[model samples]
Target: MMSISPHQVISAFDEVPTVGHCLVACITITSVLYGLYQWLLPNPVPGIAFNLEATKSLFGDAPGMIKEVSVTGEFRVWCAKQVKKMDSPICQVFIRPFSKPWILLADFRESKDVLMRRKEFDKSSFLSDGMECMGSFHGIYPTGDKFKWNRQLIQDLMTTSFLNNHVGPAVYSKGLDVMKLFEMKMNLAKGRPFSVKKDFEYASLDVMIEFAFGKNWVHTATGPQVELLSKLGASEVKFDALDQPVSFPIAPIMDFLESVYEAPEIVEKTINAIMPKLQTWWWSKQSWYKKIFDEKERIMKEQVAIAVNNYRSGHVKTGIEHMLMREGARAEKEGREPDFGSEVFRDEMFGDIVGGHHTTSGAMMWLAKYLTDWPQIQSKLRLVLYETLSTAKEENRLFTFEEIRRAKLPYLDAVIEEMLRINAVTVTREALCDTTILGCPIKKGTQIFFVSNGPGFLSPSIPTDDSKRSETSRAAKLNDKWDETHDLTLFDPERWLVRKNNGEGLLEDDVDFDGAAGPQLAFGLGPRACWGRRLAHMETKTLIAMLVWNFRLLETPPALSSHAGFEGIARVPQQCYLRLSKI
Candidate 1:
């Protein structure tokens, strides 16, 4: 039904009218029906409704709100501002009549209820079917049982235990590489402003190579002198020393991953989703893509070959090794032959790697900015690190994964939480069946967005249900409850620290994951939440600690301050600049 074009629908409607009088009568009836729909159809969760035609119109047609949403992660910040003013915790937003009405929820409890309960909400096919992406594309678009099997297979690699051994040292080593590179760049610039954007991007990709492969693959630039598989989309990797070079075919593999992540829009998605074979046939004809896919296949073969060799040898700790072993286990369990060397296996391993690598690295940009804008918090953080990691500092060594995890640094914890809150994406889910949230009916097929950043993250305190209290006093109470000492919008980690024992610090446990959107949700909620979250936190925490202990982020560079970042699936800060003398 969806595959049928609008022109065909219009033509069918024209055929409904037999003659001139009949055509006039049919037009009147259609107009009346549309008017009735406008009048009825439950008032969409009320706030400042969008004037799509006036603001979004080109020559004059609603270009849709998704263009903005798809292009920038910052749109959620704007959404955060709008939904906060609505009367209820959940609001409804419709971009166009053809599109599903977006159920926007500010209440974290409701978000959890929907996200956690798979019976009620399954991940909408928008990312896959809506985008016309082929198949459930492994680490890309998730669907059905294949997703479950793949997720289960890769689950161990992303776990806190596995990553603690694998990721911590790799991230620390890469983080140091970045620090040294930045120090050199600062020295060369003298007093001029220098950017840390390249450092973040390259360090992230570099870290991934070690984390994913576990064995030597490609060793590109570590400082300013070398090119990071330059033909690949990555910016540049700088070299601190001229040394070892690891050879690996990196470009085609990374190119495919990049292309998959950045899928086409609604129209193309619809056509491609409905007619995948034809779509595939057409896409394969493109010479550029043919080369890309061929290269991708070659890279996958190389990866498998290396992973198999590593397994045969004693060096079997890599993510690829974990995946390959799991595939073997599954074959024994299911009474079928082991299936390796397939696209499915490739997607699961590479997809998880890319997801963990890019998102985790992207998060550093936001954390850096927050630290730069709030130097006092940075100072306090350094104190905590020095006290907690004093042994490591004196020993001239990196803190172990356990030490980083178990350290009594609530301020650092709070700072990390606060950064995640202000910059996290509001997750979306589609109703698999008819569901009701907080008494509001969510029809089956409805697409809902859990606005985690609004009341849950930034608000700090949500409204108390007391109909007797006036809105003004309630507003005052919210201000008093959530933000008594500072502007909630500013980068303030102090807000997360509350009195515990004799000192102030983060709540006793992972407070962010609270159903109400305190610190818990940047990764997501429930069983289906991000498997890589713990590893992400550990890696970022290690990097942040290393950077803070070594240097102070003095002031935000003008370019950085205005940086809205790469407004996409993840809102990555494009640049982070600081003028510093090594401590």
Candidate 2:
């Protein structure tokens, strides 16, 4: 079913000889037959078949995903609707025309089963291969022995102690820098709507860079736009949804990394089949890819050089450095050579930066937008923050590290959980071998996406079987902490609150988020979940508190909200032009 028509047609035109013409005709006709065969092939898996027509693209679903998904943030909501409408917790959807349909599991129980059965379903090499195309292979997208090996070092570096003593303090320090920049923007605004996004980005990147390389690069990397966001746009735009187009600078790198999300057929098989030769050809001369790739590797090598020099001088300050040291020691003890120079190790650090940088920022941005959008929820959260971090009131400033670290704030915890659920981060996996997920014949090498939003939404409603009961009452009975509002479409932090049945909406303790499987797949499920999730939570809550304490962020035009489209490997918040008033 692979394409061969163009080459054969070319070959036929090149010669008029009888033998050559006949061969070309045969090849061209055979290619047509093969393509038709693939086109007419039936679904290989046994399940209810559904396809998002918009998700169809030249590269299969990838383009549709970019247009309707990464840009608009509609994928999760649509999936949740489909699961509810069909009444099937698990279903199948074609990734592209003529590609094997991948399974989509919406029910928590089945999804958890699929997640736990790692022997049959594990991380795919589709992204691993794409990373190689960029410059090097990454441990972020791998399975089996390689994942375990990389994981050991990652675990040591992201341990609780490292986060508390190092990463936490570092984030707080950078967050203060962000607060200062926000002050500049506020002064320039004179009570107007402006984007703190650039400052937000710098702060997140600043923390991550220091965490990864023991250095701060935000001040140097920040653009003039940071100081001018307020004056560039009018204050009127913040009162309502601004419907104008806003340019995103991060599009290119996001597009480059986007191959990781391509359909199983296109990326998993086709890219692997075609890219290596093309890569070899393009890399030889002054091609666009060659120049970009060179620049990328150049940056990585430069950082690696600095990090190594610092380590030798007893100046290691980043988690990466600690990870490498632990890994090196372990390798020495095992009498095996450590691989600091390997492409895998180098890319692992790159992966951390790429993975951590915008994602945390994007999540924080969304949390901010939601806080603005959901004013009632904001009031509740503010109350919780004030009561929990009461030490802050002494000076009426940002919460200290110790105050922020004080035991869990139920509303705050619930808000973070709900934000992640609504803005679900997707994880893609391929069947490690021929296997069945929930009795469906999952073909080998089929890339399946495990989405958190669908299950996270559904789990809160699943345990209660009485549909006759009010949705709110049923959902509350199942897990009262945050089910006060049953409208899943809206942002409700109270959904994570414990419900006490006393003829009134009463919230008690915080839900056990760490162990909660159904709704709390923010870091994903089972062993292959996100390694940096704890740090993600810590930084997000800390940054959120910093923002909330310093100012009262009012609503933006819907056009410049978290729901706005900003396309990339992941969906990001765009044009968040909130009205910021100093508290």
Candidate 3:
């Protein structure tokens, strides 16, 4: 009700500073209010469980995670631990500051539902962002026309005929080289426990390189080891202690094999960045990155030229040749020339090499540890191999690809399944649109982490009723629950094997491996599952049969045999040592 005169207002305005000062003051106030609002705001999704402190800060869970990662050097396991910390099957964490919180779902039924039913979910932007460091045409891109095209291009490589005829034989032949390398190492170490992790990794890389480029492309990683050890005697290899790991001459960074191994590590680092695509751009500008990138490009160009020449000569033995053929077919269908040097072709081949090597190596590394720890299981597997491959055993020869593939070794299959389940890899997906999971609403573009090493997998599942799941999920339910009689945390292969009545009624104790008896997301699920699963199974089974048949994996010292593992693109054992004796 009080009226102010113009003179009084002028006097008050004169007390204030310049316009710039007033503007600065306004900005400061606005910023403070915005900060407060962000800090006080609740999680973006209502009714979903999250860390309480995250909702009270602008950065959310990122600071805590950065701290944890700095100390532990692990990201995937820490993500899984959040589910246990919250004591809920579904929980959210804000990893990317200012972006939407990531939902961590540990329940297999719901996670499977989301992955299997692709309408509500698709490959995460996180994947495409990570793969951006590689190229836009990499197969990990989100579900779309691009993904379909990339998949179709390499579809022939994964076919049953190609796998059995081409991949199986190549894997078996390379695995023999690995087994021989281990034998030479065992001799040099003089019964000492030594690291075989690199050997396994390199051997896998060799197989992948061959798989990608065909037998004519000579770039085996284990070739250097074979060359080195074939010349050196036991005393010539200089090592101090009998208990220590033997060191082989290091391969240079520019070496094609080593470069292939190191490139994926950079991709892993890039994806872990706050802004993955931006990080990739920054990395691309750096000299070190450029050097590797250039070297890989050079090699790929050479390989592509060789593959083209080979195809012209009617040589169709390699994956690249088959891909070129597929491209020709597609081009004919579309009424266009096949682009042999296309980014899509190059990216797919490189992506396959990177993806195939890391995952298979990780699995093989874990297999060595498990075999060393449980000799009984090892012995049982050996017995089965010997029984199933009796002709090879009687002839005292290595098992053939056909022999191993045709053999119905239930126990061996169980071991592989159990290992995959226990050490299942982490997978990511993004919501395609606004959707609900386990009765909780999920916003579009929300990144969801489906943990394979968490509840309903490595531990007892958090109880939930079927009524809470989506009607589609409930109707599509096919998997049975894990047998509650056994401890979930234990690594027992028998969990996958169940006695079944033979239709002929001749064998009452016949057992079959039931993959659906329990939860497993090792290869993920549905349309976007691991593309190389069949190849992985074939390679793993053959390698295991060969290794167990060739040598008795002796137990290692506790210090050398620690089960502690560090998670990267794959969860690899901190220590993978083998003490072997010839069978």
Q: What are the lDDT figures for the candidates, one per model?
A: 0.60, 0.60, 0.82
RMSD of each: 9.7, 9.3, 4.4
lDDT of 1 by residue, 387-490 (tens): 77879888877676577767766667677777776667767677778756665667888867777667656664455344423333233312223542355557
Number of the predicted model whose lDDT against the real structure is largest: 3
Give the CA lDDT, 0 to 100, for residue 265 in model 2: 18
Which lDDT tens digits does candidate 3 get at residues 433-530? 89788889899999999987777888788887678888877888465546755787777887888777644211213667888888989888988888
What lDDT does candidate 3 reach at residue 71? Answer: 71
Span of 10 residues, lowest total lDDT, candidate 1: 239-248
Q: Alpha-carbon error at 482 in model 1, in Å?
A: 5.9
Instruction: Order candidates by lDDT, high to low.
Output: 3, 1, 2
What overall lDDT, based on C-alpha atoms, would model 3 receive against the true structure? Answer: 0.82
| Cα error of candidate 3 at position 105, Å | 0.7
After TM-score superposition, the amount by which residue 106's alpha carbon in candidate 2 deviates from its true location, in angstroms, is 1.9
lDDT tens digits, residue span 95-172, model 2: 444656656666444555566545677765544554444333334445657667666666656778878878888788
